[model samples]
Target: MSFLDATIVNVALRTLAADLRTSLDAIQWVVTAYLLAVAAVIPISGWAARRFGARRTFVAAVVLFTVASALCALAQSSGQLIAFRALQGIGGGLIMPVGQIILARAAGPARLPRVMAVVGVPVVLAPVFGPFAGGVLLDWAQWQWIFLINLPVGAAAALASLRLLSRDEPQASAPLDLPGLVSVCVSMVALTYGLGEMGRDPSATAVLALVAGVSLLGVFVAHSLRAAHPLFDIRLYRDQVFRAASLSSFLLSMGMYAGMVLMPLFFQSVHDTDDLTTAALLVPSSAGAAIATQLSGRATERFGGGRTVFYGALLGVAGGVPFVLIGANTPYPVIATAMLISGAGAGLSVMPAMTTAFRALSPDQIGHAAPQLNMVQRLGGSIATAVLVAVLQNGMDSHEPTQAGTMSAFTVTFGWVLGAAVLAAWTALVLARAQRREPPRVDAPAPAPQSRA
Candidate 1:
């Protein structure tokens, strides 16, 4: 639900603008605000889960998300919707990290690879379908259904969590680390918002925000190193395995999601497909990811994460090669094949890196670890998107505005995408080398426990 909502509303941006009688600029915030809110709250999610217990936190987040969705559906103006969306983002921010913590604890370190692979289905599926779903809904129903659709899903998840999720004995709750929390929030919000601004305008304020954010992040790291019970345990990064996993994860996201942004535009602009058709064409990528995900668990188990991801990353780059010289006249089958290969590589690489990272941490650190990786992933996507967009624009500027020019822009942009894949492969090699030094430890199977509440 969280992932779906994030991208679904994007297709509805124009519909939302028309229905709400707002400008495109104003309506864009509907997406940006939600992202900012999510980033802002993520650092604190670990503390919240530890303080309240993962199950309770999960339930509350679902309730908050459901209620916020309804509020967004009924919002009378753009302001109301943006405000509701921010609340919704907070709910989403909590859901992702807290839910990961619950799953991590339940699966334990040994089964984490298989479990994360299962958990990844929806994450990979949602964005693939989100725009398609929204486009379909707008074709048949009112614009508000976009938000309203979440109500039932959220309610169902909340009930299931209540019944199925295990209860953890609450740790001795400490007072909220005000300084650390504030610094992290400021750092994340500033950085995320600044990156968003860089995408749109690259204004002076955004530059200032970026500088402030980077400076604050340094302060937060220093403070976290010294503070007892820091919101995020910075010490986790000291471990070579965890650091490698995090680096690989960040680079993969940077490459994968930037390519995600570029592909839809390629279909719509170059192929001249409608939104629905564009979405349809992209299905092959998601399908490939899903199929690869099913195989990744056993593959990782047999081959180890580093080797698995390195091979996958290589395949991903091979898949992207078709696009570098691709033209408007390129056939759909060929493009789809490339996407399939890239998606398979993505599936092979991401989950194992994540699994490896989780195995390196204790259960108590899972909450922090999940959000930490999420933050990196989100920032990576943002940076990649910005950089690629600039590359496309620069390529276009140097040529006439013709079909050939569009191909030139994308072809050049794809080079950067290829570079990103190469970088991901290098990081995967790093992860693999680290694993060789200390192999991923798989635990003996343990008995499952029943829900406490």
Candidate 2:
């Protein structure tokens, strides 16, 4: 639901502008507002769980997301939709991390691989399908249904979480790190705002916010060092395996999410495709991801997370090559093949890296680690989007308005995506080496069966 919301509304942005009698600049806030809200709220998920118990927090998040979605559907103007989207983002942001806290604590190290596979579904595929989903709703129904569709799913998820999730004892008496919360929230909100703006329009205010965000983040880190019961423990990175996994996840996400943007643009601009057809072309990629998610856990268990991630990253790099060379006349089958390979690469790598990180930590540590992991991944996606979109937009602006010129712009942007994928592969190798250097974690999984020589 969260990831879907992240990308789904994009297909409707132009329609939204027309419907609401708003400018594209104003309508873009529908996305920026949600992203800013999500960024602002994510750091608090672990703290929220610790304060209210994971079950309660998760349910409340679902309810809030659901309620906000309904409000979004009912929105009478652009401002109302944007505000409601922000409200929805607060809930969308909390859902994943806190749910991870609950699941990781419950699953323990041994079951985490398969458990994470389950969690990876929406995380991996939602963005892939968002446009298709949105296109369908708009074609068949109303733009409002995009938000309203979440109503049933969100309600079901909330009820399920309430019934199925185990309730941990809440640390009701834990003192809030008020300063840490404010600094982190401000930093994230500012940084996301900057990145979001940079993607659509580069401006002086965005640059200032970016600098302010970085400065405040430094201040937050310093504060966390000294504050007792800080909002989240930055010290977890002291564990080499955890640190490697964190870096790998961040880098891999930079490639994966940014790549999603490129192909859709490629099909639309170069191939002269409609929204649904472009989205339909992504089905192969989505299928590949689904298949990889199921297989990644077993592969991780047999080969180790780092090794599995390396192989997955390689696949992603291979998948990316087609795009870097894509043209207006690029074959559809070739595009579909690349999509599958890239999607599989993403599925194969992302979870194993995260699973590897959690496996290296004790159950008690997951609560401390999960939110930060989610935050870094979120930041990675934001950074990637900003970089890629800005590049593509600038290229388009500078180039002649021709099919070949548009193709050239997309291909150049995709070269950056490929570079990020290569970087992701390098980090996975680093993660593999780091994993080897570490002593056996207290939460290590069962040994792989010995191969016959």
TM-scores of the models, in the given order?
A: 0.85, 0.89
- Pairs with steric clashes in candidate 1: none
Worst 10 residues of 1 by lDDT: 444-453
Stretches of model 2 off by over 4 angstroms after superposition: 13-29, 76-80, 159-169, 193-203, 439-453
Root-mean-square deviation of candidate 2: 5.3
Model 1 stretches with alpha carbons more than 4 Å out: 10-32, 74-83, 163-171, 195-203, 362-367, 385-409, 443-453
- Cα lDDT tens digits, model 2, 1-453, are 888988787667657878999854567567656766776677677667777887898899999999999999999999999899989999998887776666554465567677777788887887688877987888788899999999999999988887887767877545777888788878877886787667557799989999999999999999989987787788889998899899999988887777655566667667777667777877888888889988998998788889999999999999999888767786889888998999999999998888888777765566566667777777677667656766777777779989988888888888888888998898899889888877436564321111010
Highest-lDDT candidate: 2
Q: lDDT (CA) for every model shown? A: 0.75, 0.78
